[model samples]
Target chain A: MADTVLEVRDLSLEYRSRRGPVKALRNVSFDLYKGETLALIGESGCGKSTMGFALIRLTPGTAKITNGNVTFVDGPNRINLMEMSENEIRRFRWTDMAMMLQAALNAYNPLIRIQDHFIDTAKAHGLNNKSEIIARARRLLTGVQLDADRVLPAYPHELSGGMRQRVLLALGLLMQPKIIILDEPTTALDILTQRSIIELLRKLKDEFNFTMIFISHDLSLAAELADRVATMYAGQIVELTDVFSAFEKPRHPYTFGLTRAVPTLHGAVEKLESIPGSPPDLVFMPSGCKFHPRCPFATDKCKEVEPKLTAYGGHQVACHNWQQVLEESQKAR
Target chain B: MALLELKHITKQFRQGKKVVTAVDDVNLAIQDKEIICLVGESGCGKTTTGKMAAGLLDQTSGQILFEGKDISKLSGPEFMAYRRSVQMVHQDPFSSLNPVRTIYQTISAPLLYHKFAKDERDARRRSIEILEMVDLTPAEEILDKFPHQLSGGQRQRVSVARALTVNPKFIVADEAVSMVDVSIRASLLNMLRRLNQELGVSFLFITHDLALAKYFAWEGRVGVMYTGRMVELSRSPSLIEKPLHPYTAALMSAIPEADPRLTRSKERIVLRSDDIPSLTKLPPGCHFHPRCPVWLEGKCDKVQPILTEMGPGHQVACHVAFDITGGGSKISAGTR
Candidate 1:
């Protein structure tokens, strides 16, 4: 897709807690093209947030980026994020890429005025013209449908949760980064607020044409927003495919279980089929195929042997029996 | 028989000298086998009403009748027994289930406490059976596992199993599926529907997601709440297809359709006010008048609107039901 903007290859993350090393991510690979949203979706502890944090090197002191490479192909520079020095990453971060973290309320400085926070971010990046920066900030705020006057002068506490989120979005867009990563940006908002925020993101993306790496636990929201969907389970991407294909024909059993679990807006009342077991503890993960314990379709081979992600018809699935699962799911329907 | 009936039930909590009326006078009925959905925003009082139904909180006035008996009068063991019959499945499965306890121990505790089984062995057996009913097969393996060992979805299943262990006739699932991932939410919902059909367990499925509610309940009645008041209640399909209340119509429009092709042109109803009016200092007359889109001037501020029947079984509490003056257009109940 026109020289992939960001490429994540075989990314692995580990954390050394008091208990021991917790393997949070394993061989995670994906590519973000310009002007597209790639949704990384899974349950709470499925390492989705871990991946986002790892990308920005925001993981806690206990955590470490153990393996893999993240390559950012900017205009003239092809930078390997992992290999780059701290100073290099600092320069690359706001200019080439930026992140909109979860917990928008806590992300900003409570002591500072909302507009000052934007000014600080812009100034640090060497965009010193106050009027130019202010104008840009106002335009970005307007892009998210927030009144600049009302929001700019107000303190963080004065603004609502949704407005704070819009401010975060505007701040993320201030640098005009090629790639923007959002980690569950709407998780804390109410349903209506989430709807508006998501709608705003969609509209902003269309207007700005920036590549987005959207990470969330809400599969339904992801299915709606993402061009391609990736389902993560215990440190690995289990299924990756186009949104329509993933929903219509999910190959991975874990993905199937996830889809079956989500309650739809309009349909007959149906029982949510839950995965049989919990996620494996990352500190001492299961021997092979972390999902084996919960998988209804798991066999002796599944427990004894780990499966590699295999590509077929533009979909990548890490399951021993994707063919059988696809057939069985079809038959059930 | 209807397992529980909430007749104009309201609750007001006293904070210092101020009184915060959390639940406004609202009417609802829970039949023996029907899953009634109470959908609304955060401060809508669905949880307060559920707590009242479970006898966890005392209603300010009005009646909370269980099996035609007023539960407010029930005391001590009688109240405890009433609590046993109405089980609440909370939003966070992880926090709800004790982390240190085994699945069997957690599930069997209720059965043992209520003296449902003769002995510990029987309780264990019954617990396993309930687990199996929720599709946690090879129940023996799951029995010994602690809450931390279970996945979010599995933990939620254990929560359901524990609730069912008491063999409650009515279950109040307050955002039961909200915390879990969407892929597994449908399956859990399907299991609940099965319990309703097979065991005749009535459910009060409370959530903010109207779409999820529509998919999980049958012959279901939907109540829309706004600012601690039951704004609208109607048959599920009717509520979705033709929402009578302006609030309900606005909420329906807010839902992002999964199919982007089905584009709706409805103007997004962004509530102008940031904070909900503290119940302690609520506006006069209609509680929702301050925030309502269709609110009229003196009519909404001076007079409280009773929930009048708009059609067969359809009820709405709004002073400007027929006004349709504000928000730039009129939304007739017939068009909804």
Candidate 2:
């Protein structure tokens, strides 16, 4: 909690669509401490991934950061990521900050051997000697529980889905950046493979003391890995707290619904109570609260006035009716 | 109560000259209005088994009896009618539902093809009622919209409605809600449960997720598949609470617990460091022996173990589980 590595304040992003501009991230703010994992969780089109892209100034297609302040505090020099020059930005990537992309298997070049990817990334970041790069890649691959002797010579297509993912993870750690961002790293993999990868990451994070921002739509996976969690709903963080607080006593109604929606490994076969109604149409968003239509506890005021994030007892929630929600939840428990 | 019986069902596909055994000799029976979940990872043959049951694909060497009659021996028109009763709901609804056709057309096609409705008006009414069953309403408004216009959840509901057009007696839903959003996934799962209870429709639900397979499903049995074989089968609650097979135990232990403190600190059953095996060229004898924790020496590697009864309505296919050599340390005390 003392050593803050990345501080994001009032980050807003937008994407240009056929209809008009779609607000993706709205006033998203959080602080990631050293060696901590902050999970950013939300449903599809909820700006979870967009926030990841915005942090490194790589917002996809037609999307632009309208306003934000992402301050990197741990490095020798304190710098705002957005205000940095293009030349400075290139050096910051993979040197100061690196990202393990979602569905990273498809991002690999099919034609090239897997070793070339590490060699090229090292060369780009000023690790010039081929032997030095190869040796490091071998060590990192071993760390990720992959055989470098077999994987380095194989093409991306030749490797299985799990192997490809491990290689991508190894590449993410090649530079040993201060902060590593993982976006849906375990998705689409088998449960066993996903478990191993999660374990491996946790082990590596403890040893290296690198700050990680894990982004996923899967709240369960996020809960397994993250120290703190920020639940995003329709372009805004609805609740931000430690994992236990978020799961046991969700301040926001949306967060509560999400927590109960998932079917855990061991529990009574309780009927999953789905949140009715889909996410609001971004282009023609409804009045006041974005989640009002789906919120079970929505009042007239909720529809008329948007509530700002307020801190109460260590948790931050953007709900006008957190008191009643907490009381009712506690009573149920 | 048993409605459909699979007797020694084995399905193989020809890839050039080599034959790939997709589904091995397996026997399963689905009761009327019963929900049976086939849970496994990719290449585990759950999907292949589901496809074979739905008549979308055929078995290479076995018989599938629908309502006490061999399905393959049915007459052409009778088989066509059988196809209507055994419907399939695929994972990707967008691809399953014709993109060019409206929601109404897509649903009514099955009804019309089976001659369930006398005229176009009758087909439309039946299709609309089916849509209403799936909770796609104002059903009349979305009737004219194409698959492209509908959201992933809505389209999935439409596919379910299409399957129910002929009032099918059984449904084979292969990862039906796996591709949809989590917010809407529970609703689809509820719909399937509703259909089972209200309309007396049996389901062979196929999914890679063991947890998802048990959603709204406590009364049914779960079959755990591994490398073209059903490794374990047990009552849903019992399977999860006390998994006997090494593969099932490993798979269950790998699940990320909902709570954070337990997730971080729980003693998990981590398997040995080995890649998921190739389905065609599987490991000898016991398919999971190479990665299993309770692996035996010569017995496990030399001879494949058959499904042995470990308890009432529970079966496991692992040599170490049953103590083939009658070792006192084996798991006889834990068997129910």
Q: Pick the candidate with the highest TM-score.
A: 2
Tens digit of lDDT per residue, candidate 2, span A1-333? 558888899999989999999998888888888888899988899888888888988777699888889999965867899899988888898888998888867778878999999998999988999999999999999998888999999999888778888899889888889988888898889888888888888889987778899898787788798888999988898899989989888889888888778887775666687899998887888898889999988999999999998888779999999988877667644
| Model 1 regions more than 4 Å off | A17-20, A127-136, A267-272, A281-307, A310-313, A319-333, B14-18, B75-77, B98-113, B117-146, B257-304, B318-336
Q: Quote the positional error of residue B291 for candidate 2 in Å.
A: 1.0
lDDT per residue as tens, model 2, B229-256: 8888878887777777878877876788
What TM-score does the A-chain of candidate 1 achieve? 0.97
TM-score of each: 0.86, 0.96
Candidate 2 chain A lDDT trough over 10 residues, lowest sum: A324-333
Note the Cα lDDT for every prediction shown.
0.81, 0.85
First chain TM-score for all predictions: 0.97, 0.97
Tens-place lDDT digits, model 1, residues B222-283:
88887788888878877776676767776776676443233233346655443456666778
For A19-99, candidate 1 gives per-residue lDDT tens digits of: 888889998887777777888988878899899888877678888888899888877888889988878777777777898
